[model samples]
Target: MSIQYVGLKEIKGSLIILEGVTDVAFEEIVEITLEHGEKRVGRVIQITGDVAIVQIFEGTVGLSGSNTKTLFTGHPLEMPLSKEVLGRTFDGKGRPIDGLGEILAEKKIDINGSPLNPVTRKYPRNFIQTGISAIDGLTTLIRGQKLPVFSGNGLPHDQLAVQIVQQAKIAEGKGIENFAVVFAAMGVKNDVADYFRRSFEESGVIQKVAMFLNLANDPVAERIVTPRCALTTAEYLAFEHNMHVLVILTDMTSYCEALREISSSKGEIPSRKGFPGYTYSDLASLYERAGMLKDREGSITQIPILTMPNDDITHPIPDLTGYITEGQVVLSRELHQKGVYPPIIVLPSLSRLMKDGIGKGYTREDHPSVANQLFAAYAHVQEVKALASVIGEDELSDIDKKYMTFGHAFEKEFVSQGRNENRDIDGTLDLGWSLLGILPREELDRIAPELLDEYYKPYKKKGSDA
Candidate 1:
């Protein structure tokens, strides 16, 4: 029989502290029953010297010191796992909110999963085509890498996330059949959550997606567990079922804020910008969960999206995330205001693991050279634009004029594709070659002579300044 402790030492925010408690484990589930028979669930976050600090999943609102009963469940919070989880919708705590009835568990696994053995990790390779030219042709998402998207307020990060969910796929040659997505949203508004649901449903990919949503009005404490629960299900699908899993975590800034609020409630010393000092390790615990295992047929890829406060990249959220994740796809407010669809700032965005995933058999033989030449020429365009602003366009050299024309064509034809338009690797590379062709062949310094000979097209129209 479990012992129920009567009365509480104190209640601070969503945390309930109990003194002289015995045999309580960290992360253990606690049931707090009030005088009026209303019950709230909590998890033990910390335990020291018979004192346990429990974070209530439902915020503590109606509890009193003398009448409350706290029963330790003696086990950590666990999530029910099964193949049935796909195509389902659940709240942040992993409880089904779809009204489709309870899941028949294959087995219950603890949500706080141990990290995979480093020796067992396989190096991530193989491209996962997202069908966005800004991504596939530039910042290519490797199958098992953790690449995040850094965006600002009111940027179309949510739409980009939906687009990825709808279009991401493994390269055609891999032939592995089972692929799944685990999407977790923390503290997002109801309309935003509804948009994701409707997008997945309308695209007919809802059958392959498992959604975990913690709304803006839900208990703040539940935000902390949202990603862990989502990743746990992802691990199950990837390792146990031998399925490739793509986990998309949106608005991680809210999760960090929740961490800060809980830390403040606990009276912990603050770090930079009033956030907890352990923020880096906390984020690492989440981002590092994506990878491929040796001798395993499946992999886990992550695209964690966080809105940069005031468009500041130096903010602790995006800063710490950049340190942990492989690379970042940065969205641009400038391009957004200019009416670009994805609004990806190509120059500032990159994928570190892209090298291992692209070229030859992965995408196309000419992909690396085309990407390199495009980057070089676009960078030149920026320099030319700055000079033109200073000395006026008419005074610039003929080569500078050509670069200016290339820049306009690049943004209009290459970066700004229709929202529903999905371009294959061949089409993206072809468009890139066409844009680069506007420049003289000698200006394509990044391309090797062999590749330039094969794909380069010179301007052919009579009296064409380009």
Candidate 2:
């Protein structure tokens, strides 16, 4: 017993107000039929007394208050799910755009997702190696963790992301299974969108990727739905099919801007930087969905990439994101200008969960110590460079000159790699040890004496022999 109401009380931007509506709920879907029988979709966003305010997904360019008919569908937005969703592309609204036709849905799931209880959450461990030395050897991305890449406008974050997709894999002997990637891009230009598709296809990882793209010209409402739809698909694959899923959400800054626009249209009170006060909770609703369930064999890892406005990390988007996610991979303009491919400033970038995930049985016995030494050595590099700027390099001590040499070689050999180069964890660790060989053994205070005797001494001996 559904009811259709002809005519409306008011039309405001993308919203239409209905008077005397009963039994309607918030977030419920609504159908808008125009005078000539053209149809549009909307959802109930706000309710007051017996009146409902609906925001149309498609804009209300041709609608009038009296000529349109509104009907409540009594259900929230949902996505059609099947394992076939992989290797396919869909619009932000969960409609297929790959010309592959609609999915034969095993089930239609609410895009809002099922609520996960905190008690059922399994602690994240075991790293997912991105194969980029800056990430793998330093800011390790742990499975079931939500780590973000904080980039800026002109950086090569897109290239870095594609490289990660092409090379990311679990450590050897962890499991025979390979994980699938769900890539969602919000408010990206058509050219950028095409690049993502073409890169994935050319790299041969497209078969395992599910892309949800909301182009720059698409409706703003779709930007809001894009990531939600992608996460829902990942949730189904991970929890039901028992597959490890890694979800990459790019340009979340656009999504937050879309939220701000919608909030302005609704006349809501604006909070910091014109963003709604509920931004934190709203983000939590999405980020908190990532993790492994205690009873499930699979996991969901999230790498949410957002560009800070004007490279300002304090902007509301990245600021709030830093508060929510585990840790951030901060891209460096300095390094990018210096010809570093990944451009990740390892000092500022870290994975808080790396301690539990790497070392011993997970990656390698020397991983933790090597990573710590890299950080310490890099930090000293910056200091020595600053000192050399004031007093000439000739005036610096021998140890300081050694640090400068180590720093240059570290960036050129370790951080910079070919785009297609895929290094295993062992290769990454060996390269790290080789770089440590440039510094004297006494400076490697982070490593145990035994580990230095094992990994560092061999590298120092090889350097001496050469």
Residue-level lDDT of model 2, residues 116-224, one tens digit each, is 8899999999889888888888988999999999999999988888898888887755343557899999999999999999999998999899999999998887788
lDDT (10s digit) by residue, model 1, range 18-41 = 999998888999999999999999
Candidate 2: where are CA atoms >4 Å away? 172-178, 457-465
Which consecutive 10 residues in model 1 have the weakest lDDT in total?
A: 457-466
Candidate 1, superposed: residue stretches over 4 Å from native: 173-176, 459-466
Cα RMSD to the true fold for all candidates: 2.0, 1.7
Q: Spell out the clash pairs found in candidate 2.
A: none
Give the TM-score of each candidate. 0.97, 0.97
